[model samples]
Target: MSPQVALRKAFSAFPTGVVAVCALVDERPVGMAVNSFTSISLDPPLVAVSVARTSSTWPTLATRGRLGMSVLGSEHEVLCRRLSARAVDRFEDAQWHATDDGAVLIDDAALWLECEVRSTFDGGDHEIVLMEVHEAETFPDVTPLVFHQSQFRELHADR
Candidate 1:
């Protein structure tokens, strides 16, 4: 197999939590589905998401002062696919709420975070967007969405 395909297959072995990174741009809510979300630090409360260099949505989000990140629930499969689809309104059939500061969070997410783009760094084909969390909330009952091998999954409780 080709090197790229090999690498992609290997990467898919790792399971990741799905998150919707969103913000209000020009009074319109915009967002993208990301599986590269991670917590960076705890002292100051930091988080990060890796976005591809060719992402048109990233440019608009970069210009925004604040953003919202929603850790999607297991039931958000359709929402995840829609957010990643090209030439479609990401929020068209999705339900969400926007904070007064313009941060948009998907409804029923496992967790919600209000953040600001703190810094960015070049990653080979993607840019690592580091954000500082201003506020956060967790839904104790919601199960987080998981992505693995290009498919969505759910975590089953261990017996």
Candidate 2:
């Protein structure tokens, strides 16, 4: 197998929580699916996500004053796939809410965070974005969506 395919297969062994990074751009809701979300610092309320360098959406989102990060629920698999697809309206039929600061959050997500871009760094093929959270909300009853082995999964506790 090619090195790229091998690396992707290896990475797929680890499960990751999916997130929807979105914002209101030109009065429209724009978003993308991401699985690289990470909480960086508690004291500073910082979080990060890696965006591909070739993403046409990131350029627009980066210019927004604020952005929303929604931890997708188990029911959001279809939405996640839609957001990740090319040449289609990501929010065509998606339900979402926009904050006063223009952060667009997916409805019924497990958690929502309103944030402002703090910094960015160069990654090999992606840009690592650091954002500072301005506000946050949680839906404890919602089950988070997980991505592993190129499939969307629901978290089940073994009690």
How many residue pairs collide in each prediction? 0, 0
Q: Which stretches of candidate 2 lie over 4 Å from their true place?
A: none
> What are the per-residue Cα lDDT tens digits for candidate 2 across 10-104?
99999999999999988899889999999999999999999999998899999999999999999999899999999987887789989989999
Q: For candidate 1, report its TM-score.
A: 0.97
lDDT of 1 by residue, 1-159 (tens): 999999999999999999999998878999999999999999899999999999988888888878999999999999999889889988988899899999999999999999999999989999999999999999989999999998899999999
Would you list the clashing residue pairs of candidate 1?
none
lDDT of model 1 at position 77:
95
Any idea what lDDT model 1 has? 0.93
